[model samples]
Target: MSDRSYRFTHAITRKPAASIIAGLRAVDTGTPDLALMQAHHAAYIAALRATGATVIELDALDAYPDSVFVEDTALCLPSGAVTMRPGAPSRLGEAAEMAPHLEALYADVKRISGPDSFIEAGDILMTETEILVGRSARTNAAGIAELAALVAPWGETVREVHTPPGVLHFKTDCSLLDAETILATRRLSATGCFTGYRLIDVAEGEEAAANTIRFNDVVLMPAGFPRTRDALLAAGYDLREIGNSECAKLDGGMSCLSLRFTSKP
Candidate 1:
């Protein structure tokens, strides 16, 4: 296994369902156009492949409206994957649907089974040394404790961070740019969730810009946030921009679309 937690060699994604319009929407971005969403998804997948991680494409479940946001289903760590129990009732089935895929990829797959535990991978950020868990409406303290216990054997630690008010997920406001850096909105940074890492603030009014995913060598970010794009590039990182106009309408973005990981020996 590699030493870095974010160096992924594989990725998993599911297509958006026709019922995606029924998916959770915290903001009024309008209904997503399915055809346009697919095109964006294609571009997102292309970017993931460009990172040199083999993409494991899964079929869309017409039953789960938010299945396309696969990252909510599990946490991919260096030791193994922890199949999650999503806090959103509508999204609960997603973890079970994604478990087999994770089991096929990792040797030691663990699961969060507490009847009251509920967490989503999007709310959990795996930094180089610790797991920064966002305590939000979508993730309960029980879930965080369960997750911490599940990965304790791997020498991975978990720390709880307060999510900023009015965000759907913690990742909706911040993301790990590299081992020692975080791309965050000023609002989130003000909360003091990130203490030791260098904060690269996104352009004012581009708070969503901090949600990009750092793949192997290239970070995949949403297009149209030009000022934020410039900021990311100026910080000395390679990038691949993908248009997520449709997905954005339903509270989705680059990191929401895929579950990236590396297999164990």
Candidate 2:
């Protein structure tokens, strides 16, 4: 088996700060309280670092408010980092903004082009043998095919999983906690998605728990999901609860806030 531990790279936003989607959409929306958002981001970073993994913080983007979610526009893989084509038009600039930073961190970088295809980082998950990609409104068949070709030589098979239309992102509804197990809400199974994989059910009130992040044997979950957290603890996993109040406002869960990478040695 391959031996590698997960690492994290995160960016803190300053302007047009993280806010609730409903608040952002409001006609007279006010600025998001930055102090609270920063505190939450700091706590999350600390928790990940506690796992004995590397933690790199991207310098704050003073100009772009939405740049905090660096994971949505690019994915870090064993081969290199892949710049994505965000499905949301409002988020298109994110890819371009992430290119320079990724280029500095990685020796090689690949991209998914526009007009013909699109792919989002959150729609992609990496396993030891293959890369599982989700085909959703944001990610197309052409994009998945191109990504597959890029990683094929590395002996990685790109499995395309279909996503239901209304879900915001694939990872939002279903998160690959590890190579063998996945945490998903009932909504995902109702659509007959993710064939061949074992699904761990998250209760109705604990649906948000499906968004937990797993690094090694430690799972970082959001606060207030005691039942789900307890279940995970009972399963012999260490659980850490962090407050994600600002992220929840934008329909983001623990998984969306950051992209994790496991380095194979």
- Assess each prediction's global lDDT (C-alpha) against the native: 0.88, 0.68
Instruction: Provide the global lDDT of candidate 1 against the true structure.
Output: 0.88
The C-alpha RMSD of each candidate to the native structure, in angstroms, is 1.2, 3.6
- Per-residue lDDT of candidate 1, residues 1-265 (tens digit): 4436568888899988999988888888788889999999999898888777899889989999999999999998887889999988998998999999888778889999999999998898888888899988899899999999999999889999888878888999988888888999999999888988899999999877889988888888999899999988888989898998888887887889998887655
Model 2 compared with the native: what TM-score? Answer: 0.84
Q: Total backbone clashes of model 1?
A: 0
Q: What TM-score against the true fold does each predicted structure earn?
A: 0.97, 0.84
- The deviation in Å at residue 184 for candidate 2 is 0.8
Residue 185 in model 2: lDDT:
82
lDDT of 2: 0.68
Candidate 2, 1-265: lDDT as tens digits? 3523233333222222433332322123344556777888888888877777666676665554566676778877766777888777777877888788667766878887747778886777665556777888778898888778776765567888876666666776766666666778888767666566667777777776777777666788888877777777776667889987666665567766665664434
Name model 1 segments beyond 4 Å from true.
Answer: 1-3
Question: Local error of candidate 1 at 87, Å?
Answer: 1.1
